[model samples]
Each structure stands twice: as structure tokens, then as C-alpha cells.
Target: MPRFTDAFRVAEESGQTMAEYGVVLALVTLAVLAALTMLGANVSSALTGVANLLP
Candidate 1:
């Protein structure tokens, strides 16, 4: 009985850790998306400037 309880506890902890990892991954993804969005316009304009300078 004790062994079964211990197994269950460990499983629960593992599940919780996975959930935390999922949340962190989601947050990181959002941050990357936001950074890309903010930088996208600047990058586009820079490229356009370079293109204009080209023959």
C-alpha cells in the first residue's frame, strides 16, 4: 500500500512538472512572437531601403 501511494505521488509530481513546462513553453512562444512582430516592420523597412539602393 505504501509503495502504491508513493508511486502515485511521484506520478502526480511528474504531471505537475510537465504542466509547468508547458506553461513556460507557451510563455516563451508568446514572447518570441511579440518580439518578431515588433521587429518585423523595422526589418521590412531596412530591406526596402537596401533594395532601393541597389541598381
Candidate 2:
């Protein structure tokens, strides 16, 4: 009984920690996506400028 309770607590903690990590990863992914979206047009324009200058 005591061992089972201990195991349950550890499992619950692990699950909670994993959930927290997943949330952090999701937030970071969203931030990166937003940054790329905001910069995409500028980057495209810059590339076009460079291409026009090349040939």
C-alpha cells in the first residue's frame, strides 16, 4: 500500500512536469512562428534585391 502510494505520487509528478515542458515548447514554437511570419516579407524583399543585383 505504501509503495503503491509512493509510485502513484512519482508518476503524477512526472506527468505534471511533462505537461509543463510541453506547454513551454508550444509557447516557444508559437513565438518562432510569429517571428518568421513578421520577418518573412522583409527577407523576401531583401533576397529579391540581391537577386536583381546579381544578374
Across 1-55, the per-residue lDDT of candidate 2 in tens digits comes to 3676666555347778899999999999999999999999999999999999996
Q: Rate the local accuracy (lDDT) of all candidates.
A: 0.89, 0.89
Candidate 1: worst 10 consecutive residues by lDDT? 3-12
Candidate 1 all-Cα RMSD: 4.0
Q: Please report the TM-score between candidate 1 and the true structure.
A: 0.59
Off by over 4 Å in 1: 1-11, 47-55
Segments of candidate 2 deviating more than 4 angstroms: 1-12, 52-55
Candidate 1 clash figure, as a count: 0
Please report the TM-score between candidate 2 and the true structure: 0.62
TM-scores for every predicted model: 0.59, 0.62
lDDT of 1 at 14: 77
